[model samples]
Target: MTDTKNEQQWERTISFADGGTRLDKFWGRELADEGVSRGRVKAWIESGLAKVNGRVVDKGKYKLAAGEKTVIGAAEPEAGEGAPDPVRGRLDVLFEDAAMLMVCKPAGLTTHPAPGEPGPTLVNLLLHRWPDIAADKSGMDEQRPGIVHRLDKDTSGVMAVARTEAARLKLSADFAEHNVFKVYLALVHGVPTPAQGTVDAPMGRHPSQKTKMAVVDKGGREARSDYRVLWTGPRGLASLVAVRIHTGRTHQIRVHMAHIGHPLLGDAVYGPRESAEWERRPDLLAGLAPRQMLHAFYLSVFHPETGEPVTRWLPPPEDFCALLAGLPRECLRVGVVGMPGGGKSALMRFLGAMGRPCFSADECVAELYNPGGDGAAMINQRFGGAYTLEDGGVDKPGLFAAMRESDQVRREVNDMVHPMVRHRCEEFFKAHRDEPVAYAEVPLLLEGGWHKEGMVDLVAGVRCPADKRTGELRRLRNLPPEILAVFDSWQWPEKDKLAACDFVADNSAGLDHLEREAERLDAAALAALADRDRATEAWMDGLWPGLAGELDRERAGGEGPA
Candidate 1:
C-alpha cells in the first residue's frame, strides 16, 4: 500500500486491481488512521499536496491509473476566512518533526490572536510556514489551532505546538497532567532569604482589579513555585532568580513572587513602580527595562508520536541581557599606574583620604623583599647571594646594578615578583569584595599586564614629562637621572601607557593641577563602574541581524504566506 518507508512521507502505488479509484476516496481510506474526513483530504489535494506520477494533481475526482504513483506532501489544514492571516516571517524554530514543532517565542509578541491582541501573532506566523498545523479543527479553537500552551505577551521563551490532531491531544494531556518541565529566569527586587524556597499559594482574579491576578484566600486554585536566587546585584538592589512552576495558572509566577514580597523588576501590574530599592539606582535596575523582566529559559516535553523526551533551552534575549548588564558590581576596582615619579602615590593618597580602601603594589613588593621573606629567599637561591644583603633582605642597589647589566637577571627577578604582587592584589580584592570602591596603586600595572587581566575593573594612568619626573624624584627620593632612565626602560613609553588606560591624569602641572585631574578621574571612574550602556549597545548591535531583525520585518509587513 505504501511506496516509501520514510514515516514523514506518505506515498502509495496504484495496483491494476484498484484502478479508477478517486483521488480523494483513495486518500480517505489511506489516512483513515488519522481520523480525518474525506472533505479534509479533498482540501489537501486541491492545495497541491497530492501528486500523481510526480506531477501535482489538484482535482479530487482525478482517477488513479494502474501502476501510477500517488504521493502526498506534508498535510496542511484548510484555513477559514475567519482564521488569522498568514504573514510570511521567519520563525525561530528550535526543533521540528512530522508530528510537532518547538519554537522560541519572543517577548512582547502575543502567542495567538485574541480580542486584546488581534492579528499578526505567533499563530499567524506558524500558519504561513506549516499550513497543515491548521488541518485538524475537531474541538480546536479557530483562533488557536495547534497551540498547546502560552507565554505571556511580555514573557519570552520556548514553546511547543502539535502538527497533527493526535499529537495535539497527547501534548495537551501531558501538559494538563503536569508532566512537562518549565523553568523561568526572573529579575526581582531583592534577594530572597535562605537562598532557595518554594511558594505555595492560591491564585484567583483580583477582587479590586478585575484585570489582574492575585493570591486570593477564597475561591482560588492551588499554585506552587520553587525558586533559587542565582545572583544579587550591588547593594542588594536586585536579584536574578531561577524559578520552576509546578502548577500553571494565569500569572502564577507574577502573583506568587509578588505575594512573597519580591516582585519582578519593571512589573507595574503587580509591583509598585516606585520603591526604595529602585529609588537608589532606578536607571540601572528598572529604568532600562522595556517590560517586566521574565524569560522562559527552558522547557522539556515528551514527543507525542515517539514518546521520546524533547528539551529546549534559550538564553535570554538582548533586552534581558542588557538589563542584566545594568546590575552593578559590588566593588569598583581602580588600578593606578604610571612611570616612576609620576605622582601615582599622590593620587592614591587622595583616594585614600576620601575613605576608599587602597592597596600599593610597591608596598607589597617591599614586604616580599623583607629579611627572611619569600622574595629574599628566592633571590638568594637563584643568584646565590648576588642580590642578597647581609640581613637576608634584598640589596636594592646591587639588584639594580645586576638588572642594569644583564637582561636575563632583570626578567627572572620580574617574573618572580609579578605573581606575588598579583596574589596580594587578589587578596585585597577578596577583602574588599563588599566595599563600594577600592584603589590599587600598581606602578607597573600595564608593564606587568595586570590591567588587561581581570585583576582590575578600570586603569588610571598618571602622566608627567621626563624632565619634570626626574626633578621630582631628585627632590623626593634623591634619585639620579640614570636610575630614572632604567626605571623608564623597564616600562612602556608614557604615551603608550596613557593610550591604554581607561582614564589619565596629568601631573606635569604640579599638585594643584594633578589634584583637580584626580577629582575628575574619580567621578568618571565611579560612573564607569555603574554604567551598563556600553554592554547594551553591543548586545543590540549583535541582535539586530538575528532575532531583532525578524521582529522588525514582521512589524514592517512581511511578505504574505506562500
Candidate 2:
C-alpha cells in the first residue's frame, strides 16, 4: 500500500488512473498494508498531512481528477495515547497576567496535538512550563488545554493562551465577536496596487475537498481582511505587507492574497506559480523564503479578567528576516537631466564605471525604434507610416524633421516615447535592485516628470556655462548653431534644473573635475542607503521591543531558549 522508510514515518505519491473516485477511498485501498485505515486517513487529511499537487486537501470525499498526484505522509505507529508527553524547551513569553499569557510561537511547532501525529507541540511545551494550564478545562480538546486560538504549524508569531476557564471563555467570546485585533506581516510575490485596501469575501470549506477552504458565494461565512504595503523590492518582485483580519477563517490570509494575485511567497499551497514574475528566475527565488512568508507579528485584546486592553507583538523569526535580507533592497535611483549636450552621458558612464547600473534613454529609444518593435508600431499607426524607413524601421532623420516642422508632431512623439523610455528605465532599476545606486540619463528628465512620478529617487543636473554650452554642443554633435539654440531652448534653464535637482555636476569643467564630483556623490548615496536601513530597523524595534531584545541576543550568538 505504501513504502515505509522508517518505523516513525511513511510516505507515498499516487496517481489515480480513473477520475471521480473519492480521495479517502483511494487512500484506504492503497495504504491497507501500512495499517492505515480509512478513518485514520480522514484524520490525517484534517491535520493537513495529505496533499494533492502539493496543496493540502483535507476532504476525504474529494473527487479526484485522472492522473492527479496525491501524496500522503503518515505516522508509522498511529497515535493511541490521548495525552502526549510534556516537552522540555524554552518558551518566548511575551506577556503574562493571572488570567492569560501571551507567547511567540515558532515555526514548525504545532499549536496542539492531533490523532495519528506524535510530537512535542506548543501545548506540550506550555504544559511542561506552566503545569497549571493542564488543569484548566477550557479548550475544545484536551490536547489543546488553554489554547484559545491556533496558528498554522509553519506560521511564527505572538499567540495568546488562557490560564483559567474564565479567561478562556472571555477570550473565546472576544475572538468570536471580532474584538481581538491581529496584525500579520507577510512578504508577497507582487506589490498590491493602491498600497492599501480591504478584502471582503465569504469563506467556507471546499465543497468537495473538505480539508481545504475557498472563497465561496453560497453557504460561506463572512470574512474580511485589511492590508497595506510597507515596502517593495526591485521591479515589484516582492513586497512587505501588513495584514489585519477581522475574522479568522482557515487560511484566510493565504487564500485572500492568492485571490488578489499577490500570493504570499513560498506558500506552496496557495502561492502563485503560473503567473509569478520570478517563475523563470530560480536564482532570484532561491534563498528568498523557505516557508510561507507570513508572521502574526502583533495582537491586541481585552484582558479576560480586568477588561483592560492588552497588546503584544513579536518581530518576525530569523528565517522570515533572513528572507527579507536576501531580497534586493530598494536601490537609490538617480536621474541625470540636462540640455542635449550637457555631459549627461559622460556622467552616466562615470557612474556606471563606479558599479552603478545606468540607463540611457537614447539607447532605449533606439532599441524601441527597431523594426516591428512596440515604438515603431505605435509610431506607424499614429503617423500613417510616413516616417518609416525602407527597412520597416522609423527614420530618425525624417522624424526629427517632422518634429521641427510641427510642434503637434513633436508633442505627439514626446508623449509616446517618454512613457516608453520611463518604463525601460524602471525595468533597468528592477533588474539591478541589489545595487546600491543606479542612474538614468534622461535628456528631458524634468520635462517628463520622472522624478515626481516616483520613478527616480533623486535627480542630478548637468550645468554648462552659456559660452561653453555652444562650444560643448559643437564638440559633441557638430550640429548647426541654430539647431543648438532650438534644442537648448526646449530644456529647462541650467539654474532652474540645478535648483530642482538634489545634486549638480558642473560640466563647464573638464572630465577630471566631473569624475571627482561623481565619486563624492557615490559616497553620499551609499551613506543615505545605510541611514535608510537603520531607520527601518529602528521602526521595527520600536514596534516590538520584546522581539528586538531577542533578535539582539540571537545575533550575539545567544540562542536563549528553544
Candidate 3:
C-alpha cells in the first residue's frame, strides 16, 4: 500500500594510468562494482543510467588515466558482504536526537559505497558513534542498508538517516509521496527575466554528449521546477532561484535550466557551452568554477515518531557565492561585422538561423524613412512629381532629383541611417553576450576604416569578380558609362576589398563552393573560439581546491579543456 520500490547504488575505483583509458572503456578494466560488462559501460551512459560526478559519463573514447575515481551506476545499492569496521568520515552533524539524525554533507562525499568503501560513511560513523545503530541495521541491504535517498557528490546539503528501520520506511514514504518539501539555492549565470518562472523540460541523456542530458519532449520523464529571479549582470544574468521538483530525475535542475538556455554557474559538465554563451568556447568551462553551484538549502519534513514538522536551512556555500561574483565583463559582449555587401544581411540572417539576437540595418532605415515623413514625398519635394507614380510612390525621376538637390541632403540621409545601424549593431552584441561575431553590411568598409577599429572581431568579405558584378548591374540598368563609373568610384576596388579582408568568401563561385568557403570561414571562427576557450580555461585553472569527486583534478590536470 506504500511506496516500496527501492533503487540501489554502487561505487567503484578503476585503474587507468597504464596509458589512456576511456571513461566507458571497461574492455579490460574490472567493473567489479555491478558485475556490469565493460562493453555496456558505454551503453549505460547512452541510456541515461550512468553518471560520473553526477552528470552522465557518456564517452567510450575517454582514455582512462591513473588514479581516476569511478562510480558505478546501478538501480540499487549493493549488499555489503563483510562486517567491516566503521571508517570514520567527516560529517557535519546538523541535529542529532534519540529518535532521528540530520547531517550536512559536503561536496565530494558519496551517499554510499559503489564498492571498496574504506572510510566510515555516515551510517558507519553513526554505527561506530552509537552502538545501538547495529540494531537498526537488522533488515537493511548489506550496502547502504540505512541510506534512504541521495545527493550527487557535488551537491552539498542536509541529509537524514534513520536510526530505526520503521522510521526509515516512514521517512522514505514521506519522500515518495511528495510530503517532504526541499529547496535548493543555485547561482546561475544569467538572471531569469520576469523575476519568476518554471521550466517543465523532460530530461534524457544527450544523444552525442555522453556526460550531459538534453531536454527531450518524448521518451523522457516529466520534470517541473519553480524558480524566482535573483539578479542580473553584464556578463549575462545572476539569479537566486528557489527550485521545487516533482520528479527526481538525474540532473533535473541542471538539465532543465540548460535546456531553456541557462546553465548553472559552476556545473562544468552541463554548465559549459549549453547556456553559458560559450558553446563556441568548450574550454571556457574547463576549470572555471569549483563545482556545480547547486546547494540543498532548505528542507521540510514531518517527524516519524513525534509527528513534529521539521524544517532545516543552510546558507549558500562560500564557493557558490564566489562563482556568482566571478563572471567577467568582456565575456558578455557579442560583436557583428562584415565587409560591405559581404551579405552581412545574409550573415545576419545566418546569425538569426543560429539563434542570435538581431537587427537589420535596412529595416531600420525603412522605419526611419517612414517616421512622420514619406521618403519618396520628401525626395519628390526636392526633385518633383515627374518621378511619382499615380499611387504617390516616388518616381524614378524623383530619386535623381533628390540626389542632385544638394550633396548635404544626401549626406543627411546617410547620417540618419548609419548611426541607427551602429546603434542596433551594438545592441545585438550586448544582448548576445559577445558571441563568435555578428555581421554589419557596410558597403564602404574600407573607406570607413570600420574594420581597422571595432564593431567586429574579424573583417570578412563576400566577393564576385568585377565583370560578374558589372554584368549583374548591366542586367538591371544599362546606364551611361559615366553613371557606372561614378558608382564604381564610390566603392573600393575588388583587389583592395580582398586584401583588406580578414576572411574572404568568393560568392562568384557556385553555391557548393560558397558553402565550402563558408565552412572554411566557420573553421576559422571555431579556431578563434577555441583559442578564447583555452584562455578562459587557463584563467580559471586551479580555481576549485577540494573537489576530488571519485577522482581528483590534479591527477587529471590539463586533461579536460586546454
Of candidate 2, the 10-residue stretch with the lowest lDDT total is 1-10
Query: Of models 1 and 2, which has the larger TM-score?
Result: 2
Q: What are the per-residue Cα lDDT tens digits for candidate 1 across 1-562?
A: 0121222335555655557989999888765544456877887788787876445799988998754556664532223454576788868999999889999988888987654455478888898898776534433445565777788999998899888766776776566556677778898887778689999988766777766888877666668998988778754767888887877787888888888888988787888753434544523343566678899877778898888777767778888876776565346788998988889998888888778899999899999999988988998999999888889999988898988999999899998988888899877875675576788998888887776667788999998887778886557978788887888888898899999999888887867887788788889877876574455456535642444333334323622100
Find the candidate with the highest lDDT and give its number. Answer: 1
Error of 3 at 56 (Å): 28
Candidate 3, residue 438: lDDT? 41
Residue 81 in candidate 1 has what lDDT?
54
TM-score of each: 0.50, 0.74, 0.46
Q: What are the candidates' C-alpha RMSDs?
A: 18.7, 10.7, 19.5
Clashing pairs in 2: 58-211, 59-210, 59-211
lDDT comparison, 1 vs 3, better candidate: 1
- The model with the greatest TM-score is 2
Q: Where is model 3 more than 4 Å wrong at Cα?
A: 1-85, 115-131, 134-138, 204-214, 274-288, 327-562
Predictions ranked by lDDT, top down? 1, 2, 3
